[model samples]
Target chain A: MKYGIVVFPSKTLQDLANSYRKRYDPHYALIPPHLTLQEAFETDIDADKLTNIISEIAKKYEPFQLEVHKVSSFQPINNTIYFKVKMNDVLQNLHEDFQQQLPCEESKHPFVPHVTIAQKLSNDEHSDVYGSLRMLGVEHSEVVDRFHLVYQLENGSWTVYETFRLGKD
Target chain B: MKYGIVVFPSKTLQDLANSYRKRYDPHYALIPPHLTLQEAFETDIDADKLTNIISEIAKKYEPFQLEVHKVSSFQPINNTIYFKVKMNDVLQNLHEDFQQQLPCEESKHPFVPHVTIAQKLSNDEHSDVYGSLRMLGVEHSEVVDRFHLVYQLENGSWTVYETFRLGKD
Candidate 1:
């Protein structure tokens, strides 16, 4: 199965991301707005064993605050625009933890925690959107208590396989 | 740290169990009523890695129906009185999955999924309580959507480290 792990932002954040996504993101229909923790990867491991491992990893961390402070873009790299989530020790550690623990290969791109609002744009369009969104900016914060282990469906949409809560008890 | 995996029944079931626990189980205050999936075991693995593994395992199974039909006792073996949970393929498979995947010794007893209501009774007390509870019987069913990975605190109470939802999406 093809699986990935992610943190879905709150409805308020989702509404904000969706506002931009509806106009700019091609993948707006494929997934809810989320912060990708692990890029999608194929794995042959049975689901039972896989979830057990994830449950163990989730037990270590407490709920942490997630903050999105501004609109940003991966301009020269790919023209992907996003809500740049502020990186803290908890988020950084979680990203690194998945990288080290999951069977998938290390991500080709460096971890930049973000909620992509627009992607696959031409340079001009990217510049137009990025400039306006950057000025309008964004400021949102919420506590993230859990993350989902999700799988792709035949229809090309993502669905949650399970949600693992964060923290020891 | 010492950790275990278990399913906490719904409030209805918990209250039922607690009523009996208050009088019969000596370890009642130590933990809530639960159906154990994995026994407590000590592990040196970091929390991140452990939760990841657990999360992966949880994603495999859909929520399954749990039914406790009668009160029973582990007679000649011991004085552990419990509500006998009917075993189905889903529960059996989950138990086997943990045994095969988790880093723990094989359980000394065979898997007979149950929610303990009493234990550590004397021969006479065992007979008295077992006779009364078994006659009272129990008939309850609930859909279990999640299971918890829990850790023992310094004071010895069990606390949830994380809760992993069952099923795809």
Candidate 2:
């Protein structure tokens, strides 16, 4: 889409994912360690469009901070996955922002933000993947300063398209 | 060349040199707000050769934990620019682990690792480049994990050749 927000990891995230993978990717077939803020879609986009959107959204949002919690996973519904992110008010607010502005209204499942490490496979892939992630071990909560705009390409791979400062109007 | 890590956020790194062009294309830039561990290399690579190296290397590494810290930058020399990673003991250990087996040697730049956000412009592009980055307001000091083996393609783009687990070994 022309514009949207994405939540993935910083390069340092690879470190956290690797630690988690050492333990999880081997034993658990965790979805690769990435949590998307929302699915990408084609839309009319650009800085002017973004600036207008941000200004419109900010009018109602004063600004707030949230804490990213410890590692957790999704159950048998999909593949097991591990993620690190702010799960409280900050996340809820961002979600609320999307629902008001985007198509998140169509998601079949509730959004649970995560940064992916391993992905798509049977139980067989876990032993190696999880073991690798485990070696990386657990990481502490990190701060989130901005919201990202990412695009999922034709090949089913996701790439960040752009970013926006959340509290700044 | 056969075995190398290109670092994460390489997706839009092409934007580094094209800094003066336009902000519309984050495609040439690394994913916004990510940290890199090392200045990854583009080595002699082919899928078969790279995969073989990975399959062999994967078996050797075991996962480990690291303490990630604040944002820093590096100017090895006046003209050279880099995002600097803090040196923690655990990180040092991981560096040694990687150095022993990988085809490329660890950077002599004291491993002040970082997933780069932008390229330091040549003296020629300096003024215009900094002006652009200031408007972008990129953030740094990211946590790291899962070292990826990426392929820098002929079209001046990067594709993840393979991602390797470090601690799971």
Candidate 3:
């Protein structure tokens, strides 16, 4: 199964991100608002093994606050627009911890932890959306306590298969 | 008190890093063979508070292997030659986790996660050391099970103020 890991933002941030996604992202219906820790990877590793790994890692981290303030884009490379996450130590460590157990192929660029706002836009469409997006001036913050292990269904929508709480006794 | 956090490498790796340091680094006597997670910072936060925070974070992670290989330099910017520490999720997360609690202002760049082999060299000295050092090409790997929260003494050397074991129940 194809699996990914992510933590959701606060309700207000979720609403804000969802609005942008609904307007610009074609895959908005397939996934909800989240900061992805692990991108989708195909793995047949036993569920027990996955649980053991995540449980051990999650226990090491206390919940931390994650702030989202900047609207940015993967320009020239892709038409995708995203919110630049202000990575404090906790958020950065959590993502790194996940990568240790599941070593995905390293991409050309270092990982830019972000929440996608829009994607698959033409030049004109991107310009139009970006211009409108200027007034929003992204800003949202929330305490991150839990992350989910999710699997994609045949229809493309993702389902949360397991939820792990950070530093929960 | 001024404090720093670090993980010591295996004895073999320690010897290798020290050999390079003794030849090229001026601060070799002040510090020892270690991969710094956080540079020194002054904090009035109680020792108990510091210990509690670290203990909480340390419990969540299991020991993992760290590999230090590749001789590289932070040239033009810092003129420092170092061994690149290959950060898997464990090491990366550990560093990030520490940053959340003890944010240091002096680190102007994002953490590159390296162990300094040589520093504070004259232009001529750097060229000479860099040339001779090329043949020694670094390669060391070992399990990292514990880390220390240490403090500097009046004479400039660091002493272990506290030790936190990884994955301790």
| Poorest stretch of ten by lDDT in candidate 1 chain A | A153-162
For model 3 chain A, the run of ten residues with the poorest summed lDDT: A153-162
Q: How well is each residue in A58-84 modelled by candidate 2, as lDDT tens digits?
A: 444433432344444453664565654
Which model, 1 or 2, shows the larger TM-score?
A: 1
Candidate 1 DockQ, CA atoms: 0.03
DockQ for each model:
0.03, 0.03, 0.01
Angstrom error of the Cα, residue B75, model 2: value is 29
Clashes of each: 38, 73, 2
Model 2 - which docking category? incorrect
Interface RMSD, candidates in the order listed:
15.9, 11.8, 24.2
Ranking by lDDT, best first?
1, 3, 2
For model 2, what is the C-alpha lDDT against the true structure?
0.46
